[model samples]
Target: MADPRGLATLPPIRGRVQQAAPLAPFTWFRVGGPAEWLVRPADMDDLLLLLRDLPDQVPLAVIGAASNLIIRDGGVRGVVLRLAGKGFGDIVLEDDGIIAGAAALDAVVAEHAAAAGLAGLEFLSGIPGAVGGAVAMNAGAYGAEVKDVLDWAEVATPRGLLRLTAAEFGFAYRKAVLPTRGVVARARFRARPGQPAAIAVRMAEIRAAREATQPVRARTGGSTFKNPPGEKAWALVDVAGCRGLVRGGAQVSEKHTNFLLNLGSATAADIEGLGEEVRARVLASSGITLEWEIQRIGEVMP
Candidate 1:
């Protein structure tokens, strides 16, 4: 599925590169078109090189483990970077904290921390996506957020690498004001020593609670909309009669109204359109407009 525009102008790298790569298979919703050019760098050095050398005119985006993300129908243009493999997925314990690569799964990191008797990161067990996405956005769940435990994060901007402390991130509700074209390469999270058994019990409770409340087995992105100032998004959705609402092959989860399911046959447009419909309904039912928590990227088909 290589395109004629090709990889000639792109810098050579040790990692894999694919043109017109299908993205739906890896994403949570399992619907979307190909990436125009998908680059998976072999290591930090490879990624930094690509970031520093990539042409400024070329559009760049990092899609880590594609949770809480929707890739639209017409596909993403230019380069899409996905961090994974041995180089990017490693997790190491150091100084009562963990240094997790951008590709490390949030749950995996939580497990690693629990094994080492690290207490503070148990909340990550219930969050979706990778360490990089968690850091990029101030990902939180079950009463804790990235900002609470992060010591520092290493980011690769087009200019090069910069390790910013937690205060430097300027994190707010579910977001951060990072440098332009910044790709979070890795992050160090501080933790305190705790009883491993207690940490295990806490992690288990969070996991069980999440599984019982959310559609963990469904083809759905987690948390469709953010909780408004002092209100809950799901409650607003339920009050608006959006529970089990369907659009094409997309349906609001019966288990949790905030989640929209792919139902095996949804297109990216179907999923996103359903979300917009939910937002519109919520707005009409209540004066408050729901803000999207799941990120919609790529392009929409006409």
Candidate 2:
């Protein structure tokens, strides 16, 4: 089905807007179809205005970095907003914390934080998403999570712009409870002073560790499944004999069982199918089901 809303009826804004924009290039999977309406707002005000004036019946979605997403073959309906880094990727160091725009890459944040001698945000270096996606999913790595250091966040909600405290987010493993349609605009995180040299060393260690264990260079969605309580997802998949398991052009990463990789020509269906296959096999073997950590959006082709 095509997008039901007419772009002509939408409010004017200072941004780049397109109809039937290809979404594959925006995502890590390098697969999927197009977005019915793709809007890259020039700034937060532009985004807010667009959100406030958008038709309620017309769905809205936001994608950042697209590091952990799988867009389906049939494409997404309605307006899909992508915050450009040039406008939303600023990082400011405060007296006691760091403020980052939603579009700032996590690694960049980590590097900046280290340069400013800020500790405790070093874990962000290992996360492959932008600040918005990190907050949306409560993205974590190496025992630290966004919730642990987040002071507050500015979000664009239907009611208007609102400042939400960390506690209000109701964070959980790999998830954050946010307004049904809220868009994170910026976030401020609390950090403490530390030696820049020490912070850099820690960040470097994290990078090395990640590179050694993950298929960081492959066209793959980071982690395919969340670790079930008390059990590692990779171990479960490995025990299920799913390591290197293949479906179409997609395969479970031999380097990391929790990751699913696209071997050159995998479609969205192939990648998702491989994940489901891994989930099924894992469940059948361990009686514990694996939950997908990757956000699979859009619709399947008919």
lDDT of 2 by residue, 34-54 (tens): 999899989988888888888
The alpha-carbon lDDT assigned to residue 149 of candidate 1 equals 94
Q: Model 1 lDDT vs. the true structure? A: 0.92
For each candidate, the alpha-carbon lDDT, in order, equals 0.92, 0.92
**Per-residue alpha-carbon lDDT of candidate 1 for residues 178-227, written as tens digits (9 for 90 to 100):** 89889999999999899999999998999899989999999999999999
Worst 10 residues of 1 by lDDT: 1-10
* Model 1 vs truth, CA RMSD: 2.0
> Each model's TM-score, in the order given?
0.97, 0.97
Root-mean-square deviation of each candidate, in angstroms?
Answer: 2.0, 1.5
